[model samples]
Target: MRVRGRLTWGRRARAGAALLACVVAPAVVLSPGVAVAGAAAAGAAVAGTPVCQVRDDRLREISGMVATDDGYVVINDGADDEALRRIFFLNQRCAVVRSVAYPSRPRDTEDLAIGRDGTVWVADIGDNDHSRPTIAIWRLAPGAAKPVLHRMTYPDGAHDAEALLLDADGRPLVITKGGSGTVFLYAPTTALRPGATTPMASVGQVTLPRTSTSNPFLFLGRGVVTGAASAPDGRRVVLRSYADAFEYDVPAGDVVTALTSGTARITPLPDEPQGESITYSRDGRSLLTVSESADQPPGTRPTILRYPVAAAADAAAHPTGSAGPVSAGPGAPTSVRPAAEEASGAGARPWALVAGAGTLLALLGLAGVLRSRHTARR
Candidate 1:
């Protein structure tokens, strides 16, 4: 079904919300097969080898990624002058097995999500300049020729959104790109209406650490919310930035509250060129990522990389309180910390020692005073 909506001014970005903003691999002209499955790299920010390169001409600029029973569904950044409406389905090794074209012409298609009901959802949710009056989400059932389009409007105004998440109840949730190191959450009042303009309510906000986050003036770092995916079972939520990724344990009712309340488990996804989309594997364990293809060779072809689920789970287990680098074994992800939880433990010992010394001195002074009083009485 075809649908359209007009833009209305909702909320404009605050005064200082824009920010400034990949390499490539050699092209192997072949069908999608032979993706490298090497062990995940060690160390922080390691530009690990890619799982595979998408060589499909039409699928080269792979902007969104989602996992299916047999393969993956992907799309490109709708940044070109012409509008794009086609989505590609790729096999296990990243080959195009099929393509689904729907009536909706998204102004900028940045990411996609799969609902619990087996429907494939495409997020026409990218507004780079914050100029769009409305954003759209199109739902297509498996094997359905046509898609039902859903329009989402921000209560405040148009926002530059890239990440999309469907919570446990199958409700569409959004995290706007962070303009001031804090990303805003938005969602519809209920399960949205098809082909109707629905109002999205703001839920919560998250602020990244100082050592974390970037200036919005740079183009790449604009929102820090490039792609998002939820676990098939709805137990976990994964949010991605252009540079890294974070996983949060979803609370019973609202996942947004879990994210903004400092209950995040983060891991780095280093060295993907213009990474735009993220998804969970069919088994719902590992994470799959998609990046826009770059012209440069020897590195940075539109890449698909997998991060082990255990790595993320291990990080979440070890909340960072102690100071020092979080090192990983040969295959596990290197570090997990909320500003070094273990480091805080280390600092505590020294303070305890100082406190003990102060107590001892106080006791000694009190004894001296008592002795002097006895001598004065004599």
Candidate 2:
């Protein structure tokens, strides 16, 4: 099925909102105490170091990323231009080494995962409007010229998702992008087939606790799962939101159990303009992330940021078996803060007011632009 043109305009609106949050919010907010608290919290969290700048201008909307021995692999968030809808291979310097085309235009490719055998999986499961009949995963095995498409259907209904996890056995897991600190996980009930549609079953759900970590998207960003990665060793898995990365240990190779029952070690990633892509470093000692450059100034290139995993956490990594069955209970909170902070109450009233105003202005501008586009089409 072909993607509707309206989806492109919708993406533009979201990008504009992100731009405002990153560039306009901080400047308008003027509470001295709140500023200090925010700054202090930001400083305590180790920020990611710049590894390399993505030099290719075409890769401005990177949504999924995976690290390789030589470099990395990345995919854009379903661009309207068909020519830009390919899997990009980047060298260590973040330059495009080569690219492989998809067999057909993807609906919305949001995440990437690679297996031990060098098989690459691309998730085309993004349903921002919750209107998709079936989602798909594209597989590109080693030495293959093109990727094969595997269609999948969620048993309950359509849900928006941006994270995909591959277990030790190369089975694919899909994580929904839910609001209010809750997200559901799903896995195929049977093996995936390229020629036929596979049915997916809900494994369990995870609730990411609230954090006061500073981010461009404000309160709502903390709970949104934008991307995910599995360590090369298969002992750890990480899910990232716009604001932070949640890392969980996959003991005995039970990813669902780890996410459902275990507490994650939080790593704050503050102030990314439109962060979406994430992956583990080749040696699995650090996490790598990059943001989309669409909201940046002209000619700006996206930079790859590397955050070191704590030695204690790294030492605890162990090989896991095949992913076990879904466990009961919601994921426990690793760091709990008062929900009042989300509203930026008494301490951050000035900032909250300014931010809310900026958000409203951004939405108004986006509405005008979309209205114009519709008028022209008519």
Candidate 3:
């Protein structure tokens, strides 16, 4: 789909005219690379701004995020035969409340999306090699016994589906991750049975733009689209790819129009960031992005990046405060924040005082010994 948020004509023309005038005037180059690239891609420049960034410490290949009454729920889709797929609960402070493992089939769980009625929808759409024509979604109540399996099979043929979203009425919206992304809105009340082809509508096609650098290091055309959700008003829908997340406003309940009509907006995120799951907070003002642990170092934990959507679209558009992940192993102490950045927080008060006292005592002791020696020599 043609996502929005590209600089409008007025903005473009003004910037273009300003740049043209700059040629006639003496232009001072700021950064070396900036000047060169600015002169090259200046005309076709798209607004690349990062609203927020959170270092995920608990995310192990996070595939989706859903904002719930408790907080944000994160998805971790592990490899095949591992049986390690889990949905983690994180409060506003970025603390992990709990983690529940879905009754996942080998290599089935790919992503997750939550329904309005608080049903946690776990999508088993990850097809690494695109060999399966069918995938499953486990829908369970917050604390319900193992999820009830909801299977989805594509009609035409097999597809590598990755993103899932449930509408306000609790309908399923399954989107396939492919060269030309396909959106399928499953009919409401349709039973998701094995080998069953639910009545679906073709919304449109979407393409995720890949970043230039692999700084955050993406999984390539593998298309790690980790986020999808229907807006709170049910008038809009959101999806995320590796590099950017998109918001679409589908008014007439027409999926086709929503896809083709120029009523979407694309927001650029961090560079080559893999985990792109997003969810709107209960207040509906703030949007949160959760990163995956697979994209980081082995022992590195996941992080939650918070951004005020309304404020980001208006403010300078940089990351706000972030919540890091808690370690998984024992004796790890669940250090949610980086050690260097944790010294000032309330939890670190005792340690910070002890470190300060130790430093002071060491300096005082050294000075006293030196003074004693100096007096003896005198």
Candidate No. with top TM-score:
2
Question: What TM-score fits each model?
Answer: 0.68, 0.79, 0.59
What's the distance in Å from true for residue 281, model 2? 0.5
The C-alpha RMSD in Å for every predicted model, in order, reads 19.2, 6.7, 21.9
Ranking by TM-score: 2, 1, 3
If both were scored by TM-score, which would come out higher, candidate 2 or candidate 3?
Answer: 2
Query: How many pairs in model 2 have backbone atoms within 3 A of each other, for residues 3 or more apart or on separate chains, i.e. clashes?
Result: 0
Which residue pairs in model 2 clash with each other?
none
Model 2 lDDT, full chain set:
0.76
Please report the candidate that would top lDDT against the real structure: 2
lDDT tens digits, residues 1-378, model 1?
Answer: 011231111101111112100010111111111111111122334443467778776665566788888888887766332333587888888888777776745676768888876788888876654566778888889779977888888999878777888876778888786644578889997667886888889988876432222221121342367788888778777787765567676667457765765344555565454566788888887778876645434444566888765343344554333232333312333323332242244234434434334434433533342222210000
Model 1 TM-score, all chains together: 0.68
Each model's C-alpha lDDT?
0.59, 0.76, 0.49
Better of 2 and 3 by lDDT: 2
Report the error of model 1 at residue 206, Å: 1.8
After superposing candidate 1 on the true structure, give the runs of residues whose Cα lies further than 4 Å from its correct spot: 1-43, 79-84, 209-223, 298-300, 310-378
lDDT tens digits, residues 217-319, model 3? 2222113455676666566566666544555656556543454442334444444334546776666665566654433444444566554442122112221
